[model samples]
Structure formats: structure tokens, C-alpha cells
Target chain A: MTNLTSLTIRQALDGLKKKDFTATELTEAHIKASEAARHLNCYITETFDHARKQAKESDARYASGRAGLLDGVPIAMKDLYCTEGIQTTAASKILEGFKPPYESTVSGNMFRDGAVMLGKANLDEFAMGSSNTTSAYGNVINPWRSEAEPDKQLVPGGSSGGSAAAVAARIAMGATGTDTGGSIRQPAAFCGITGIKPTYGRCSRFGIIAFASSLDQAGPFARTVEDCALLLQSMAGYDPKDSTSVDRPVPEYFKAVGQSVKGLKVGVPKEYRVEGANPEILALWDKGVAMMKDAGAEIVDVSLPHTKYALQTYYVIAPAECSSNLARYDGVRFGLRENTDNGNLNDMYEATRNAGFGKEVKRRILIGTYVLSAGYYDAYYNKARRVRKLIWQDFINAYQKCDVLLTPTAPTPAFAIGENTADPVTMYLNDIFTIPASMAGMPGMSLPVGLSADGLPLGLQLLGKPFEEETVFKAAGALEKAANFTALPQSLMDKAA
Target chain B: MSIDINTVRKVAKLARIRTTDADAEVLSGELNNILSMIEQLNEVKTDGVEPMTSVIEMNLPARADEVTDGDMPDKILSCAPEKAAGFFVVPKVVE
Candidate 1:
């Protein structure tokens, strides 16, 4: 038989229905693949034992003709989700060894539909950095290596890096990811997979560790657009537990996949054509435009004037929210504690946070505290909030001219793990293309469209209006057919061998 | 305005993350770089715009402020680094 892990989530579901393979067999196959890919450091904690039990239960359900949507598909849960009795570190020493007594609403929904947990995937500490290097656990390596230099290790773009890498390597059928600033889509682009950050409040934030309250969103990563749709159907819903979660009916997302993009208005923002982007990436964007036009999508040029200021605005607002949200870690109720024997309360807090948080997390915290500090509040934080409105207005105006927006997911393909660490700003710039949509609370997706001259995957982003994910999926389905990306990471191919 | 070492030290203390003299010196330069990049926001004229409190249009819906969940102190304290008798232990503040 062909490798079980090589099958798409839909194909596996069909195979299980036909009794071609037991759910247990499929789960075991992915466990083996995960064990072999351990050096990629995709998971902070592997739940092999838990998976075996879940798969066995799924087999009984299949026998009883009561199988759930994801009946036995093993998948990775991004460690930011709080899983009961499972250690969920947000890839930070501050959260090290911390196990929540409750499950995040999204992850709980996945298990309710019978998705088996492979483990908690790693991410940037508190989901701070664009590259996964800020992870106190270790850097997540992208499965796709440059053809000329196989020994070089590229980053799986973050802060959702590990979830993307796990799916790209076929160790997990699909994985959950949270996007604060391009966390899901950028990594999906870097790792040659499909991912989406649904509109704000598409998925409940209950029990997921907070980064930035307004901008943070949960989404899915999968090998194909339809697979992402399937994963999202199980993961997204309104929950009273999360106040921001909208009370809307959940649509069957897969129904939107494979739909035609005929008569659709696709926008190409002139501002996204920025200076000094990779020429190959720009060429790929042109190819996407041509492909969409051929598929009957009207290509129109639109302007988002505030695009230039998005990164600057995000750097301020996100840090400000992160600073406020992370204040819960005070060596009082959770995770790591240090200098507790100190006679002073404030001294204990200083010592514990200083010792527990890694450099990047601490840096963001300092920045956040400074911006929200006494003298700088109106100058920095309030200014950023005002600018954020302008950025969102840009999208509101662009949607007036187009049904969907198309752009490159990243300025360049994945860089080597250590290449862009010279300055924090340099790393922050990696998410330039993906951040604007995030800032506006719009639903956006990234799918591998073509390979670069370096033989690494490049992706195009599809953005739709808020709560209008069906249109995004329709256009994505049309592009998936046109691009017909057939390449796989060399490492994944070798691992199967 | 660029942050100096003294500013970094002060802010780190406010964040409750202890910073040493050496760490503050290095962080001041890095923080300055980020702040200067953020300075670009000063150029955009948002004269009459309101600060963004919500990304989407919705009133802050308040739930019935009654007992929604509670009474599971063990569950809440499950991950506590240090706890005793249903409460998280903290350093003594009262002299």
C-alpha cells in the first residue's frame, strides 16, 4: 500500500469508510512519521499514547456507524491552546510545565468531531516573532530546503511555524494555528501548505493563551484548500465563553471549495507592489493574476493608501495588548516562579518574569509597557489605535471596488533560521504582506501556487471581506486548480522512502 | 524620542521583568530601532479618528453578571507554581 500519511484528509476519510484501513492503522502511520521527523522540532509535546486510545475509540465508532467528521484523523494542536491534563507551553519558559484544566473551545470542537491529537505544536514564545526563533523550546525547521543547499535550515514562518511544518511534512493531516500578525498564513506560505485566518471572532478565543486580544484569531493548516475547509468546519463556531465570538451559524466550508470563481472581482492593490521584493515572488504574483483572469475573475487595480504604515502600527498595538495580556504571569498562579522567598512582592514578580520569559518575549513586554506607560500612552498607543482605524478603512474602501484581494503571502520565501536575526525590526518585516489583512480583521488564506528559482515554495494570499470566507474559498479553489502545485518537500519524499 | 539605557531600565521595571545594567545597555539600542520604525506613524494624519476599541462593529455585549462559573479552586490552581490551601502563595507585602 502507498504511505498512509501521503493521503489527503478527504482521501483518508473515504478510505476509512470503505474499510481500506482501520483508523488505528492510520493513526499509527502518522505517529511513525512524526517520530522520524522529530529533528524538525515541530511539537513541544508528542501525545502518542493519547492518540492510540483516541484512534481505538474511533474504530469502535466506525464499526457502530457513528463516526464523526474527523473520525480518526491525527492532527497537531498548536501549543497555545489549553488542553486539559496536557502540558501546553506557548513555546515560552514562562508557560513551561503548565497544564490547563480545561480545553480551548476550538480544540475541544476538533476532539468532539473525533480528531485525534498528535501533540502540542511549538510556536514563537507567546506568539511574538515572525520567525519561530523566539520559541524558547527551539527553532522550528521548514521541511522545504533550497535545492542548492540541502544542509541549510530555513525557518517555518511563525509564530504558527510548527503547525505549518507538521502539515507540510505529512506528519499531521491538518493542524490548528492562531494568527495575531500573519502567524498562520505566512508560515503556511513558507512551508508549502494551505492555511487560513478566518475573520475576527470566527473561532472562539476561550482558553487559548492571549497575545493581542482584538487581532488574534484561530484557523487551520492543511495540505489542500478543501482539507483546510474540512478542518475549519470542525474548529470554528460561536461560543458564549468568548465574548468576542459572533453568534452566527457555522457554514459547511467544504461546500465553498471547488466552486467556480467566474464573474468574481479580484483586486490587486497597487500599494502591495512595494520596492525591493523578491523578483521571483513578483513574477509569481503576475502569474496568479493571469491565472485568475483566465478563470473569469475580473482583475482590477485598487489602492490601500495606509498599507505603508501597517507594520509600524502593528508593532505598537500588538505589543501594547501583549503587555496587558501577559501581566497574568506574575509567579502567583501559574507556570514558573522564581525568587519567591524574597521579602518583597514586586521583587518576586521582577525576578520570576525576568527568569521565566525568553529574550524576545521580554523585549516585546518592555516595548508594550513603555508604549502604555504614563507619559507615552497618547503618543504611541493611542496614535497606533487611530492609525489602525485608517488601515481598516483602507480595506473597507478597497472592497467597494473588488470582491477579493490578491497579494503575495510573504516578501520572500523562507530564509535560513539564523539569517534575519540581526535586528528585531528585520524579523518583523517578514510578515509585511500578510499583516495588513490581519490588522483589518479580514479573513485571509495562503496557498502554494508555484516554486521559486531556488526550488522552494512560494504562495499567493487570498483575502475576503469580514465574515465572507465562502468567497475566499471559491477563489482559492479556482486558483488551486490553475496552479496545480505538485511539488513536495524533498525531506518528506525521502522520509516516505 | 529614542530610548536610552535608563529608559529601558525604567520600563523593564514597570513591566516587572528585571533588567540588569548590561541587558539595559543592549536593549536600549534595539528598542530605539523599533521606536524609530514606529515613528513612521507620526506622519499619518489621524486628526479626528477615534482609538480602535473594536475591530468589528458590535457593542460590548455584557452577559448577565451572575455566577457563570466558579467553585473549582483545585482546577484553577492545577498549574500554579506554588499554591497552598486553595490560594496561590505570594511574597509577603505587609511589613
Candidate 2:
């Protein structure tokens, strides 16, 4: 009765085990909270029936003393992940009625571990944009609004915007997100939740809708670092279905949550201090360094010279891959197919795509096609690929100097919706700090460190070596304790209630 | 690196997505703007660098050529927009 929705996943699990509350009670609380917060627009589909059924099943599991890792824990899934019977839209009209006959490997793993589906969270259309404005479902309003102008709606950072918002608003204990280019971290930073994109192939990408195959990695967004670790524990594994999935053993990530970073060397990259970044964000970065230093980790300055070119490289590579991946959505197979009375096959393809895709999606597809076209391939696509290698090498060189790298998650705190939507270049700049890690296939996470001048949450990102999520979690855990970020958007939740 | 309307039309056709003259004109301007930002890649010099195809430099794992999956044509075609006897229906290729 005392706001069961407010409890973290760990607390919820413990309560379920102790018989202090039933999974149905917890699921009901969250369902009521999600209903009250309709204005947030975080969920594209609210699976009330599915959640109630799953919670009831979990209660049965508890009765038999056979509870799984996440038994009865209510959480949200990013709409991009295909759920067998559920409509997985990927926040695009192109996938509006798409009911995948099979579940994504990652989601299948989570369900096997006893996680309940609160619903599918909204995202950028095909996970294309930095802001949730590109979602055909609607923009997901951030639960964290500026103190001075509480009426002014802010954007929950994107492609994982809804996942971050749902967790921040306490509608769900945790949520799943995928990062192609800062989708998870940027939105997590904006909404003041903790999110991590594990190393590429750490978690299978079998069922999650592909954005850029090379960079798209599924991850979790939770209220705390430890919660993220627990969620990732179940999510990360090897699956033959996903060819890129590493055959390495999935480490006990949750055990690394509270490990000390006493003698660890933390690298502060100089290139992250880009021109025109917010002074408050820079101060927060310094504050993060101080926090880590106080926790007995040595902070050393290192340089990744190719960091500045990461955004440009990502724009080219991601779009090129997207252009190829999205080609599967022609009218004949599945999803939306425009009915152009008596029109030819080609006309249906064009009409369906033109109608189904949003502006950003179309823009990316066009850019992708142009770059991979004859005569332009070498100058654009090939050049970007080489630059991507240089970007990877830059991280490789920096990691030799320290065990992990630290930087601000974004240039500033979350901006108001539509602020940068008109200018695609301005929008792409939001990903500057988070892109290099994606290009290098390293694990990266963003956790709230402090508040901005407007009293909005600001996050600091930590980058670890390839498949080295444990190190990142250990360092982030120490910083989380040092920072003691206890701020929550309770007022927003209360208003919604 | 600037793109013109003619290039936009050509590329749109290549992508098999329909566009009108006005949409192509607007797309051209948008493409040029994006291309200008992407043109920054030229600033980096990578004479001997190999164009990285993927992050982990491993050859794709080979699998035995065996029937690991099959026997669900109905399930696979469940979401098809138009379907006929065990196949996806599309506009006629011949008159």
C-alpha cells in the first residue's frame, strides 16, 4: 500500500520472497501508476493483461519456492524488442501491427528469469533520433522538469527515451534498452536513471530490431547501478541464433556491483572537454573525478584524438547499416503496405515506406543509400570505415594508460522537446560524448552524478575495455556510493498519481 | 560533397522508394546539409589503415549446412500483407 512501485527491483524481489507483498499487488501498483502517468507517453502499448498474468504466474512460483532471478519484478521493454504475441512497433508506423511470431533472444532470456512485462516502452521511430520526438507514437515527456519552469515539458533523451522515463517515473523497476549510438546512455542521463550498453555481442541481438548491426547492443536501464548489474546478469549470454554473440561465459556481473575500485586507474579523457560544452556539465565531470579519487581510485588524464570524428563516423556507418537492415520491410512480407489502388509492386514499396517512416528515418535511409551508391562508396562509406578504425585505435591507445575512462554523458542536461529537432546537425551533436565507445564496441554506462543549474539531473559516463563490463560496474559502483545520488522525480510521480 | 536534386532522385530510385519532384528537392537540401557534416571525415588521414568491417576482428563462425530450422510456413507467413498458397502474394510480374 505504501507505493510498492517506488521500490527498486532488488527490494521488490526481497519483498516478494518475504511474503510482505504479493507480485500481483506490486504489478497492480505499477499498472495504476502507469495509467495515471499517461501524459508522459512512455509506453506505446500498456500490457495490463499480460503483466497481470505474468505476475500471477510469478506468485505461483513464489508459493512453490521456485522463484527465478527476476520473479514477479515488473519492468518495461523498449518497443524495438519483438515480443511473440505482443505488438512490437519500434516506435515506427512501419512496424505498427507487427506481431513477431518469436521472441527476441534477450527478452526470452528475461522471461525465463521470471521478469514481468509492464509494457513496451516508446522510442525513436526505428530508434533513429536523439530525441523521442521522432516516435510515431508521440514524444515521451521527461519526468524531470526544471524547477523554475515546472510547466515547460522536457524531453527524455532518446531512442531509449521511454525506458528511461518509465524507470525515472517509478512506473517500472527497470527497463530494457538498446544502444546503436548513445540511445541508452543519453536517455538514461536525461531521465536520471542508470543505463549500460554492454560490449557489442555481450547480449544477443537476435530479436531486437537492428539499427546499426555493428553498434547496436542491448542493455538495461535501472534506478541504480546494482539494479542494472542484476538486470544485465540475466540479459547477457551466448546464443547461436545471433552469430555475433560471443561464446565467452557470462560473468556474475551483480557480484562485481559493490567491488572496490581502490587501486584502479581511472582515465579522464581530454578530448571529451569539447568546445561549447556546458560549464556545469564540466564541473560535474570534475566532481565525478573527485568522487572516484576520494574512493581510492587514481584519476589520470588521457587523450583520444579521434574522439571529435566519432559523430561523423557514426552518422555514416549507422545510416549505411540501417539502410540495409530496414530493407526487409517491403510490403509483401510484413508490416504496413500502402494500398495504392491497382499500383505496381515498386509503387507499393515506395508508398508504404514513405508513409510508414518519419522524417529522421527517411533522412537516414537516403543518406545511407547515397553513401553506399556507386562512385560515392569510397569517398564516404569507406572513408568513414577507416575513421571508425582510427576511433577504435584511439580508445585502444588510451586504455593502455588507465583501466577505465570517464566523461560527461552529454553536452548538457535534457533540453526541451523540439529545441533541436529542426536542425539534424545540432541533434547529432547530442551523441558526441557517447559515440566513440560504441564505435570501439566497449561497455559504457551513464549514472546520475549531480544536478544542473536548472536543478535537472546530470550524468557521468564510464567507458571500459571490450567485454569488460565488470570493471565498469565496479568503478561506477564506487562513484555511485561517493556521489550518493538520491534525487528522484517523486513530485512528478505524485502529480501524475 | 553537396548533393543536388538530380542525385536525390537517382538515389531514391535506386532505393526503390517513390518521391516527387518537390520531395526530392527538399531531400536534396537536407542531404547536402547532412553531407556537409559527414564531409568532416575527410579531415582524418588514414593512408594505411584497414577499413574496419566490424568491431571484433573475427571471422564469422561457420555452421554445418544442416536443416536446423523449418516446418512453420504458416507461422512465418502469418504477418504477410498478402499471401497465396504457401507463398507471399505480390503484384503480378507478367501480364
Candidate 3:
């Protein structure tokens, strides 16, 4: 059998249906691949035992010809999702060794549909940093390397870095990711995989650890757009537990995967052409436009003037929401506690949070508190909130001109590790092109468009109107068929061998 | 606007996160850098624009008054740092 681990979710399902391989065999192959790829540090906790048991159950169901939608598929979950009786740290020491007694709505849905859990993938601490360097466990190294410097390690963009890395390396079939200010799409773009951040409230946020409530959303990362659509079909649904979860019925996402982009209006936002973006990325964006046009998509030039204010608006709003959401981590409840001798309540809260959170998390908390402070509220938080309306209005106006917007996913391909982590602002700028969609609560996707001269993958982002993920998927599927990106990291491919 | 050590310390206190004087000094520099970067938001004129609290623009839907969830304190308390008699143990506040 030619490397069962390399097959996409659809192919794996076909093999299982044909009885070519048992689900147990497929699960074991991925577990072995995951074991060999440990040097990448993509997973925080490997659920081999749990996966084996689930695979066995799936095999029995297959024998009886009673397979679920995602039966027998082995996948990774981003550590942000709460897996009952499994440690979900969100890659933060603050949540170290904390296992939820219940499953997150999205993960629970996947499990109910018979997806086997391979493990919990690592991410930035509290999903904060753009690079995976902020993970308390360790940085998840991108499997992709530039031709200029093969020895130099690159970041698998974050805070969904681990999920992106794992899927790219083929250690897991597909993985779940959350986007609060471009976490999912950015990492997927860097790792040369397909990922989508559904419009906010598409997936229930009931059990995912909160980073920024309003902007945070759970999505999927996969090697192919079809695989992402399959994973998202299971992950998205209405949940009474999460009040923000929309009551709309979940669409047949995979059905739209291969749908034609004929007569589709693809909007090219003029404002996304920033000054500092690499010429190679800009060229890839143009190629994406040409590909869409060839596929019968009308490439309309539209304007989103408020695009420039997205990063600043996101920095202020996400931190403010994070500051409020993370306040529950007092020494008393779940996770780590410190300073026992000091019987004072105030001292305990301070000691616990200070000892628990990492440097980046601490910085965000401080910035959030400062912006929302009594004196600075109107100057920073309120003003940013009002500007957020304008940013959303920019998209609302632009969508009226066309069906979807296309832009470069990031300014450049994956940069070397430790390249931008030194300066917090520089690190924040990594999501420059992707954050605007997140702020406006639109469904956005990233798929590989082409490779750079240095042999690194470049991705083009497609943004669709709210609750219109099928449009985004249809257009991206057309691009994926056109671009046909076939590069894989040689080192990880050798390791899998 | 530049953030000084005093400002960092004050915000840290308000956030209930412990920071030493040295940490405060370092944080002040870092916060100032981030603040200056985000200060660009002030440049965009948002006249007569209402602050958007939620993206969906819907009021919180009221539910009928009834018991929808609860009665599993054990599962909830299982994750507590310190628990006794089905209660999370915290440092005493009342003197």
C-alpha cells in the first residue's frame, strides 16, 4: 500500500469503503507518522491509546457497513479545544495539566461523527503570537524550508501553527484551528495547506478556550480544500450552549468543494496591495486573479478603504476581550495556583496570573487593561470600537460590488524562526493581510497559489460575505485546481519514509 | 502616547497580575512600542459611528425562565486547583 498516511480524507474514506485497509491500519499509520515527526513538536499530547480504541470501533462499524460521515478518519485537534479527560493546555503553562471533563461542541461533533483523535496539536500560548514561538511546550517548526537556506528552520505561522504543521507534514489527516485575528488562515498559508475561518458563530465556541470572544472562531486545517470542507461539515452547527452560535442550518460544505466558479464575481481589493509586501507574493496574487478569470470569474477591482486600520483595531479589541475572558484564571479555579502562604486574595490572584502566563500573554493582558482603563477607555477602546464599525462597513460596501475578495494571505512566505519574535509589533504585523476579514466577521480561506523563487509556498486569501462559506469554497476550489501546488517538505517526507 | 513604568505598574495592578519594578520597566518599553503601533487607529475619523459590540447585530435573545443546565458540580470542580467539601478553596478575603 502506497503510504496510507499521505491520502486525503476522501481517499481514505474510499479505501475504507472498498475494504482495501481497515480503519485500525490507517490510524496506526498516522500514529507512526506522528511518532516519527515528534521533532517538529506539533502535538502537545498524543492520544494514541484513545485513537486505537476509536479505530477499533470504527473497523467494526465498517464491517457492518454502517460508517458515519467521517468514520475511520484519524485527525488532530488544536489544543484549544477541550477534550474530556485530556489535557488541553492551549499551549500555556497557565493551563498546564488542566483537563476538561467535557468536550468542546466542535470536537464533540467530530467525535460523534466517528473521527478518531490522533492527538492535541500545539499552538501559541493562549493563541496570542503570530509565530509558534510563544508555545510554552515548544515552537512548532514548519516542515517547509526555503531553497536559499534549507538548514534554517521556519515558523509554521500561528497561533494554529501546530495544526498547520501537522497537516502539512501528513502526520494527521486534518486538524481543527481557531481564528481570532487570523490564527487559522495565516498558519495554513505559511504551511502550504488549505484552511478556513468560518464567519464568527459558524462553529460553536462553547468549549474552545476563549482568546477574544467576539472574534474567536473554530475552523479546520487540511492538505486539500475538499478535506477542509469535509472537516468543517462536521465541526459547524448550532449549539444552545454557545449563545453566539447562529441558528442557521449547517450547509453541505463538501458539496460546494468542486463547484464551478463560472460567472462568479471575484473582488480584488485595491487597499490590500500594501507597500512592504514581497513582489513574489504580489505576483502570486495576480496569478490567482488570472486563474479565477480563466475559470470565468469576473475580476472586479473594489476598494476597502478601512483596511489599513485593521491591525490596530484588532490589537486593541482582541486584547480588551482577552483581558476580560482570561480573568477567570484565578488561583482558586482550574489550572495552576501559586503563593499559598499569602492568605490575601488579591496577592493570590496576582501571584497565580504572573507565575502562570508567559511574557507575550502578560504583555497582551497589560495592554488590554491599559486600553480599557478608566482614563483611557474613550481614547483607546471606544475609539477602536467605533473604527471597527467603519472597517466592517468597508467590507459590507465592497461585497456589494462583487461576490468575494481576493488578496495575498501574508506579506511574505514563512520567515525563519526567531526572525520577528524579538519585536512584538513586528510579530503582530505577520497577520496584516488576513486580520481584516476576521475583524469584519466574514468567512475567509487560504489555499496554495504558487511557490516562491526560493521554493516556499505562497497563498492567496478569498473572503466571502457572512454565512456564505460555500462561495468562498467554490472559488478556492477553482483556484486550487488551477494552481495545483505539489510541493512537500523533503525532510518530513524522508522522516515519514 | 508613551507608557511609563508607573503606568505599566498601575495597569498590571488593575489586571491583577504581579509585576516587579524591573518587570514594569521592561513592560513599559514594550507596551509603548505596541501602543504607538496601534495609535494609528486614532487617525481614522469615525465620526457618528456607533461602537459595534457584536458582529451579528442581534439583541441577546431571551429564553424562558427554566433550568436549562446545572447539577453537575463534581465535573466542574474536578478541574479546581484546590477543592474541599465540593467547593473551590481560595484565599480568605474577609479580615
Candidate 4:
């Protein structure tokens, strides 16, 4: 029998097609693994019966010779996605009981392609924090370490921490994740998996809950770059339902995955080599560049000087957009409504919002409202926006000399749970490496490089031109094959056995 | 740039989050600390720069001015804490 824990989506699909295993058997195995990995808190809500039903339908489709790329593949949807009739919380108390009547475009697309819905995974409330600790549902534990050191739990990263952890732990074949300021890439780096944040507007945001509408883009988290390509192939396309959805034709993501990266120009931004970056991370990034050079690729020095301004611009722009997007949850509209004294409208609004939103959500909204307010608008919001243009222009200039840009995915590996929570500024600084691409609305991905001295995973990021996800996958696929870091944390393997 | 308890209270009201006087005092210190850190942006000079709303400057496809959605009054009202016939109910403001 094939070791279910080690099988990739491509392997599982081939097995299912050859009648080596039924979709029901595959679904059951994954469910069993998910149950075994429950201590990690990877899933927020699991639909066992729903998954089985979808598996049976997929089996029926196979029987009728009507299968698709993702048929019967079990995948988890991040809680930020809207699932019809399923509770979608975004891991916040404000949306505690809110359930959407319709499915988001990405979820709907995946379902239509015959991917089995394993369950909804956990995330940072409204995808705000870099560490998963900010979730109201409790923190998701990283499953990569040994069980002997149970007390020494590493963070699974955020705001897509659960999605990354579940996929890394073999709880699911793959999972969908959204990236806004490195939500997907950073966590993928932390969890030692492959995650891609496609060029903005490549995937429709019609159903995915908004954070920073300008920067948020949905992609896939999986064990292999090829698998990420497969999931992205199915998840991306234009949808008229979303106003910002790009009208361009979807490219074949998997077509170029096996392409060689010989002679490809990779840029290393000098600005990313800053003080406070962990030495191990820098070493790993250097090793990655050397490996690429060995594989007949050219390493070029590129300048993205506007990188220093990315965090400042993102903080302002994202909060401003979030302030407007989160305004829909006024207690009377969709979620938790507080008890009101009579029908006093203003008081009612206040009570409902005060009772519904959490501390972090409130903080962002206040910051957003303050920056957008008349007296401070020019000083804060407009100034940040002006800097944002320069940041985008920086990428346009860098892409001229390189096919892809490379950097450490994060400054350091995952920190302890409560370490950075008290200091919001330090927490925001964790996004330094990941935000530049997001601010410029370009496609970026994180591929596992190696482990740090402490045994935690390190990640290498690849930045590509807008809508040129194929280039990223081609380069990432090359690196992944060359590095071949197959060291799964002992905890996951022991549980599987 | 130092935030105070009064500013915290005003910001809390504007954000529609209820905060106690004690909470405001604590928040005043915290918000001021955060602002002090964010004030680093002021060090960079950005005179005569155009404000950027998006990374790309392509013209977005415009939809015709036609009604594409129908009334979902029942669905809309389903989320309301207080509702009347075909509408969400709130406190009387003008009267």
C-alpha cells in the first residue's frame, strides 16, 4: 500500500484514476490523519459527512469517466472564505456566528472542479497578525517538532497558519490560502511548505472576505511546487462578480513547472540585507543563490530601495481599506448583535460593535479612521499612498534586469506565541520581507530552503512580474528539486505511524 | 503626537467600540507608544509626490449602468437584529 502521509496530490490523483484506491478510501485516510493531528488545532470546523458525500460523488464521476484535475482531492479552505451554509468566522469573535448564504468565488471554483472540502481551517482574525496567536479560536500549534518537547511549541505563522500547518502535517492534500502582506508565504516558510500568492486580480475576490482589497490575493499551499501549480490552475480565472477581477485569460500554471531554469536571471535585492535579520536566514538565502548559480542560473544584484517604505505604506493602506470593509458588521447587518437600550440608533450601533469586534480589529479600525479623517488625511493616508507609488515603481525597475527576485521569506523563523503580541510594532515588522511584492501587486512564492540552527524551517521567496506566475513556479520548482529538504518533523511521522 | 485618555475615548466612540474610563487610560498610553513608533515615517521627505491608489494604472472595465441585482430584502432582513416589513429597523432619528 502507498504511504498516504507521503503522497502528493498528483500521486493521489493518479492512484485514484488507476483504481489503486477509491476516493472514499483516500478521504477516510485523510480524515484519519486529520484526527490524529487534532492536537495541532489545524482545523476550525470539519465537515466529515460533507467530505464523504463529495468523495462518493467524485467516485461516481470517475465511474462515468468525467473527472477533473482536482477530483476527489481533499483540501481545506481558510476561514476567511465564504462557504454557503457553513460558518465562516475569519477566526474572530465579531463574526462568531456569521454564516454566508452564498459561497465565495474561489471555494465555488474548487468545489465545481471536484475537490473534496475537508473543512474550514483557522487563521488570524481578519488575517491581521503575523503569528496565529491572535486568533480568537486559540493558537494553532506547529506539528513539525518532536512530541518529547510538547511544551516547546513553535508558531505555525499567520494569518494562514492553519492552512499551512494542516497541509504540512499531511492532514489534507492541499489547502487554499490568501496572502495580504505575506499571510501565505510567511506561514508556508514557517511550516516548510510551498505557497504561492498570485499576481493581484488573477483570482477573483468575489467571495473571499476582504482585508486590504488592493493587496489580497488567493493562492494554494501544498507540499510541492507542482502541486501548488495544479491548485492555482483550478483556482484562478476572471469572474464578473468581483469588480477588481482581471479580465485576462488564465495561463497554464502546470505547463512550465518542469521547465529548466538554466540561464534565468535571479535578482537579490541589496535592501533586504538589513540589520536584525537572523544570520541563519541570511546564510540559507546565500546558499539558495549559490545552488541556483550551480544549476546554471545567473545571480544579479538588483536594487529595490523603496523596500524600506513598504511596511509604512502597507500599514496605512491596509487599515484604511479594512476600516471600510469591516464596517458591514454593525451588529444589525450580519453578526453578533449586542442587547440595546430601547431603539437608540447610535447607542445600538455602539453596543453591537463594541460587543462584536475584538481588540485588534478595533485598533485597526481606529487607526484607519484616524488616518482618513480630514485633519490627518494629508499627513498620514495620502503620504503613505504617495510612497506606495514609488514602491511599485521600484519593482518595475528591478524586474528589468531579472526574471525573478530572491529573498529570505521572513526576518527570522517563528517566534514564541506571546513574544511579539504585546508590541504591535515589532509584530508588524515581521512582514518586512513579504510586503514589498504585495504592495506592488506582483506574484510571489516561498519555497523551503533548509532548517535553522534551532531546527525550525527557513524559507526562500521568489518574486515574479505581474501575471507571470509561471516564471515563479519554474524557478521555485527548480530550487525545490535541487534542495530536496524532505525532513518532516518527527511529531507528524510518529502520529501517522 | 502623544495620545491621551480624552483622545482614546474620542477614538473609541468614533470606532463604535465601548471603552471604560480605566480602559481609556490604559489605551491612551498604548496608542501613544504605537504612534511614537509610527512617527518614524515623518523622517522621510516626500514633497511633491503624487498619491498612489493602486500599483497598476490600467483602466478597469466599466459595467453598464444597468440593474444587475434584484432586491434581497428577505435575505438582508435575516441578518438584522431588529426588522420591520421589507426593511431593517433602527431607532427613529428625524422624529
What docking class should model 1 receive? high
Worst 10 residues of 4 chain B by lDDT: B30-39
lDDT of 1 by residue, A10-104 (tens): 99999998999999999999999999999999999999999999999999999999999999999999999999999999998988888889889
Model 2 stretches astray by more than 4 angstroms: A493-497
- Predictions in order: lDDT: 0.93, 0.91, 0.92, 0.86
Tell me the lDDT of candidate 4: 0.86
What TM-score quantifies how close candidate 2 is to the native fold? 0.98
Q: Which tens-of-lDDT digit does each residue in A415-448 have in candidate 3? A: 9998986779988988989888888899999998
Which run of 10 residues does model 4 chain A get worst, by summed lDDT?
A143-152
Q: Give the CA lDDT, 0 to 100, for residue B18 in model 2.
A: 80
| B-chain TM-score, candidate 4 | 0.85
Which stretches in model 4 have alpha-carbon errors above 4 Å?
Answer: A146-150, B91-95
Ranking by DockQ: 1, 3, 2, 4
Please say which candidate is ahead in TM-score: 1 or 4. Answer: 1
User: How well does candidate 2 score on lDDT at residue A61?
Assistant: 95
The pairs that clash in candidate 1 are: none
Interface RMSD of each: 1.0, 0.9, 1.0, 1.8
Model 4 CA lDDT for position A302: 97
